[model samples]
Target: MQTANNCNFRSSALGPAPLPYHPHHPGLPLALPAPVAAAPALPVPVPVAPVAPLAALPTPPPPPPPPATIVQTLTRHVPVPVLVPKPFPVPVEKLVHVDRPVPVEVPVPRPYPVAYPVEKFIKVDRPYPVHVAVPVPRPYPVPVAIRAHYEPLHHHHHRHHYLHHHHDW
Candidate 1:
């Protein structure tokens, strides 16, 4: 008799009882002797074609006479209005030009031979020139819409939520 961790292996009838089934143990099917490599599959013999059956089809029938057709007439009527002739009512008034004279106002010229102040552009020299800044552009996403100010008239009533424990008293 041999002993292993509370299990007994006796040198008698039942040979070791095959250990308790572990996948890593040497008692699996792969540990048995392999089949003879299957004899190289024998090449699978070539198949023969199928033969025709012994039955045949039936024959066709004779000609049918020309079918008789009855005539039918469907009519729909609609009324159209006819127009009448009349004279046109246009009033014609003949107009002609009337001739008369009225007095007119014209400005007298300032007889000097020089350009007016409004027509002259002059550049004056100074130490400090007034700076008008050109704003530097920044890369930002352009807004597509400008929303109007709006407020809802009636507000919904909502209760304040509280977590319940019952022992929080």
Candidate 2:
């Protein structure tokens, strides 16, 4: 049967047999592997010598004094105001209306049988020039010789020479 001391092994079949708790019986001593012999002791190292302290550095010279500044006072004048003369005022009046009789208009007598000039339009036959259709002469096709040379003009001198030679053609 399994017990607390025998819990080290997961399988009870391979574990050690469990011992009963006894107040008088002393517990069985744990069976451990034999103690291993320690390796040989290493040699002691020598102590290092202490270093000397460094010397203090010399103090630096003081900086130059700053330049002096100038102070000045400024003054300004104020302008005076001038007075102008005022113009004279004009008087205004209201108009009054008076009742008056209007004159009667007289009709003038007209002369009998008034003569008026009448306008007359006459149709006249005039001969005009007539347009006639005429056939235009077609230009005859002429065969011309054309020669083209494909060349790369890399230099400015060569391009100018080629243009001058082809200008006449």
Clashes by residue pair, model 2 = none
In model 2, the number of clashes is 0
Span of ten consecutive residues with least summed lDDT in model 1 = 100-109
Taking the tens digit of each residue's C-alpha lDDT, what string does model 2 give over 18-75?
5544434446445545789799899899898976555455557788766423112112
Which candidate gets the maximum lDDT versus the true structure? Answer: 1
The prediction achieving the highest TM-score against the true structure is 1
Superposition error at 146 for model 1 (Å) = 74
Cα-based lDDT at residue 8, candidate 1: 36
Clashing pairs in 1: none
Q: Provide the clashing-pair count of each candidate structure.
A: 0, 0
What candidate 1 gets wrong by more than 4 Å, as runs, is 1-33, 50-169
